[model samples]
Target: MNDQTKTQAQARNDWWKGGVIYQIYPRSFQDSDGDGIGDLNGITRRLDYIASLGVDAIWISPFFTSPMKDFGYDVSDYCDIDPMFGTLGDFDAMLAKAHRLGLKVMIDLVLSHTSDEHPWFQESRASRDNPKSEWYVWSDPKPDGTPPNNWLSIFGGPAWQWDARRQQYYLHNFLVAQPDLNFHCEEVQDALLDVARFWLDRGVDGFRLDTINFYVHDKELRSNPALPLEERNDRTAPQVNPYNHQNHLYSKSQPENIAFLERLRALTDEYEGRTMLGEVGESQRGLEILGEYTRGEHRVHMCYAFEFLENRRAIASWVVETFEKLGEVAPDGWACWAFSNHDVRRHATRWDLSDAANRAYVMLMMAMRGSACLYQGEELGLHEADVPYEALQDPYGKEFWPEFKGRDGCRTPMVWQAQDEFAGFTTSDSPWLPISPAQAEWAVDRLEEDPGSLLHHYRRAVALRHDHPALARGDQDGLTCDGELLTFTRTDGEEEIFCAFNLGDTAAHMTLPEGSWTPLAGVMSDLEAGVMDLPGWGYVIAKREGE
Candidate 1:
């Protein structure tokens, strides 16, 4: 490549550094061919709509071959597309369309585990002496016939499932059908690296690694320590679930995980500008692990922790304190911020924010000091669906029931047209999941025409990030939460932007830092640059040029 072309390509690759990623959960996004389930062609068809949002990339959830045990997360085949989602050619078409629209594609890679139906797992379970027998985490049961350790699955019960054929138990951090791969096995790591390479060769821009922290385990199979109730938070698991009862020291977050990540990083680094965004699945020490994992350039590009997604109300003090903690822990590390995703309940309802509060947060995320992620339905301000028990499809919900419903509430089909019976997610009357009646009111067609809708607010907020270098990839400074107003400054080179948000029940105001500032247009505010008044759950932004 010529020098200028190489530089241009490099710049495009760097879009991930501080760009926004819009997540598309295929099963719920859009369905073509009347399958009632979304596919590659569905996503390709919506490329224009996605590109119009001004996002840098799209992070697609798993669509690999699976038994539908844990949806597509339980990969039966990593190299091929799931027939339900479409063929390999369909994926290629989707990639080409996304690239043509100037949007990068980041596919989800579930490397920590595989469905028992996977060829390797099928062979491994046939007998203990198979070539792939050691590829999965297998251990002998205690003579009395119990699991190898006290490890608990996030899905519930024991982490180990006894395989009758081999008379041994295999570890599974998630569903019993999904067995955790033994990362201790060099062969397994090499194989996953190859899976990553397969996608890179197919022209993927990056990856959203599922459960990145769970790749390695304590080889000795040590029992986890019981966490005191006060110390145990329902961030990793639901409150009613037993998975949150223990401190997962040996089960995951082993010191050896860094090496495997470095190896994966080295592989991605080979293809210039490709990035890795890992989902760190720890409740305690989540930010710590995220910081350590993304500390250096040799590791993954960035990691998102469950701190914001942990089902807690995102109050002003907590948000400021969390960022402060992250700043102190991993000042050099990059974080990918999101209020909601496929796994958690939609933040619009989870946080119970008012319309103004929701808009304020959109500004907060866009102005934050890291990359950002917007879940598929978040832009329309869709709340989590109330899927009745009879219609509940998530295995996790089926296990926990009553108190803690599964993520199916958040994973329901996206609403496209309000007038359509099924909200235009599919032509079939029966979608994989139900289309929420409440969400239909906020459907794309309805919101698309309303300039004041949350959809338009999202577009405007995103455009603001694109227009201001300080907001997109700036250095965050002077973060302070006073009363109900949280204030900070983002500086990129000589461009400095002052931002303030009132995340409270009452109106609030803040005094600007010592500088002449000009308020940015488009945002509603009764403003002079030096002092600003903010309503309950409101925000203001002003910029000052460099000296």
Candidate 2:
């Protein structure tokens, strides 16, 4: 290996590149104090379990001080830990334990906005002439007493909230309690950067930036144009959500966001092994923004859009088209792909996948060109929990009601023991959200005893990716789709591997590409000669004999 080759190898081994990241929704993971809510101490106790999954890192959802209006996303204090989640000492302990187990910790950072109860927001809304008054986006109402512009909130209704204290309207892209910060103000930008520095100094490995594209809004406060019915897709928001009616041109994904990202990247670069994984939430232009945000070194290291999570059925054609689009628009950029997370419906139930399909999807995600994220219960093949209407907590779901249930179903507690009344998640009878019967059946203890369980399959699949350099950090090529079958190739210098998937239930036959190959174990599939016959939801990962 020469100097250039050594440099390429080091880049490939960088933790964020094609590495597996497990997402832990803090409030639902485990409850150490038995208060029916997961806390920092609980996560500290489970560090070994997380590390056993063969993931390179863990991305924990928000556990910051907040009023819980939107859970921890509406942060009231950026530097402090919420009492419900334990103290700063508890967080440090968790961080130490995670590092000891060789798992990097990436925390969720909600920098685009802050809770209304935050001191800065309280001071900003106090009086328009105050020094911090411009810290948040505030504007005078229209002459007719309507909002300053036609922007709409993601939680339904107009995006502007009339504040009697300042006699002006404030902007909130999500819930009214979560007010958008004035990134246009250099002071606000500097303060946010300081927040990032605080966490970095505290030993955090990296950050998962929430709503990264919404960092900067249109300075002119222009109204967003109406989206044509034909162009509107239910990818970012639910079909019942009125937020999909507009194109959102002036509201988010603004050009100015790039400069702020460069500044943020520069800050992260100050520390070794630090990275940023941004979440882009646009419906039509997600890939384009992803490419722009991560195009160069001085920007977010990687990004993931709503495409895979929103697709009810990740058909072969859909997967092929998505990657093809990425290759065209973001050839130089990187992406962190995920099938489920804290905010959406779990893929197992959302897609109505069979046992085979579930296994196949996991294999496909691991074999993809970039990094991957696995939600907490995905390894056990847990579906979305059934949260009763009366027990719902998500404001988004509560507002939509029977028409479209909110995300509480997916945010339910993880079932650790099948026989425990609380599924071993907590000793308390009452959890934040009930553990559904379906999830209980796939409990960790139960899956651990079953060798053929989805849990073991996930473990082996993840390990296989790590063992094969071509699958983990190689460049993807030759993507093609034939009816319900999808095929692709990955190569890293002298090593080459072929991957094929049958996304349907019935057996499918296809002619394999010309190559002297050897089948790799762990992935489910059957191949004979040049003809490949795969059962429904079957897949194969093979290495070329001599490439």
Candidate 3:
């Protein structure tokens, strides 16, 4: 390749840095077949819609071979595609189409465990003398015939399930049908690494490692200590769930995970432009763990914790404090921030923000440092769909019932045409999850016709990030939080930009820093003379030349 070509290729290889990733949950994105379930072809059919948002990549939730116990997270086979989703051939076709549209594809990889029905787990549980006997976390029952320790499952109940075949208890962090892999075993780590290679070889650009911090547990099988009420946060588990009671030191986020992450990163490095985005689910020390895993050149490319996706409303102080803490904890590390995902309530509903406030957050997220992930339907300003008790499908929600209604609300089928049955998600009368009439109003077809819609706002916000080098790849500085007004500056070499926001329902004023600043396209505030006036939920992005 010519020098200019090599430089351009290197820039593309580093695309995950400050890149915008659109997340798609396969079951809810769209269904191509008449079976009411979305498949690989459905995603391929919607690539044009995804690319239209000016996103750099697409992060698809798990579609691997599975029994759908936890949707597709409980993998029965990592190498093959689920027949419900489509075949391996369908995945190749989707990958080819994604690349052709100039979009990188990152599939979710569940490495912490596998479904009990997976061949390896089946063999391991069959007998203590099998070749794969040590592939899963297993231990003898206590003398009283109870669990080996007091580790609790995130899905509720004890983390161990007694297997009559081996007369021992096997560890399961989530569902009883999902057995945690014994990462301490070299063979298991090697096997999981092979799974990563399989996808990379299949032309995938990267992976979003699911439950990345839960890969390794304390080898001693020690019980976790109780967390003080003051120390406990609802970021990882719901306030109603008992999983929040423990500190979770022994059950997950073990230090041994770092070496495995390094190994995974090394494997991905072999393939050009491949990135790893890990999900660290720790409530107390999540950012610290994210720092450790993504601290160096040899670790995962970026990691995201639940800081921004928590239940609390994000005021100006909260936003500034969160990133300030992140800066202190992971100064050398990188993050992929998102306000909503399939696992949590939609931000529009979770934050209960008005249309103006929601639009302000879109600009905030796009202009943040590191990278960003925009959940499916976020562009259309869709709220969390209300799923009745009978319609609920998430196992996590079912375990915690009324108090914690589960993630099904956020996982409902994406609306396409406002007037179409099932919102054009499927021709079938029944979808995996029902689409609410309220959600259908924000359908793509409806939003496309309205230039002032949130869909257009999202596109404009994302375009600003790509247009300005300071916003896309600069270092954040001069962060100052004044009550409900937050201001910061981003600088990259000679390019610098000042950003300010009013994350409240009251007017605010800010004195511009000394510079000849010009208002940018994404600004929503009024500037006069030397002072700037921001209405409720308003923001401004000004470029300061010759920094």
In terms of TM-score, which candidate is strongest?
3
Question: Each model's C-alpha lDDT?
Answer: 0.90, 0.91, 0.91
Q: Report the candidate with higher TM-score, 2 versus 3.
A: 3
Question: Candidate 3 residues 1-547, lDDT tens each?
Answer: 9999998998888999999999999988889998899889999999999999999999999998899999999999999999989999999999999999999999999999999989999999999999999999999998999998989888998999999999999999999999999999999999999999999999999999999999999999998999999988889889887888998889899889889998999999999999999999999999999998899799999999998999898788888888889989999999999999998999999999889988999999877787999999988999999999999999999989999999999999999999997899999998989889988889999999999999999999999999987898899998888989989998888888888888999988878888677788545344435586678888888887555
lDDT of 3 at 454: 95
Clashes of each: 0, 1, 0
Error at 258, model 3, angstroms:
1.0
The TM-scores, one per candidate, come to: 0.97, 0.97, 0.98
lDDT of 1 by residue, 1-547 (tens): 9999987897776789789999999998999979899998999988899999999999999999999988999999999989999999999999998988999999999999999899989888888888998999999989899998999999989999988899999999999999999999999999999999999999999999999999999999999999998898888788888888999999999999999999999999889779999999888899999899999788889999988887777777988889989998889999999999988888989889888888888888898889999999899998999999999989999999988889999999989999999998899988989888888889999999999999989999999999998898889988889887888989988888888888887988777788667776334454545566677887778887443
Q: Write the per-residue lDDT of candidate 2 for residues 1-547, one digit (tens) a residue.
A: 9999988766643779988999999999999998999999999988888899999999999999999999999999999999999999999999998989989999999999999999999999999889999999999988999999999998999999999999999999999999999999999999999999999999999999999999999999999999999998878888888899999999999999999999999999988888899999999999999999999788999999988999468898998889989988999999999999988889998899888889999999999899999999999998888888989999999888888899988889988999999999999888899878777889999999999999999998999899888898899998888889899999888988888899998888877678667788534344447676777888888888866
lDDT of 3 at 384: 91
Error of 1 at 212 (Å): 0.4
What is candidate 2's TM-score against the reference? 0.97
Runs in model 1 with CA error above 4 Å?
A: 1-10, 521-526, 545-547
* Global CA lDDT computed for model 2: 0.91
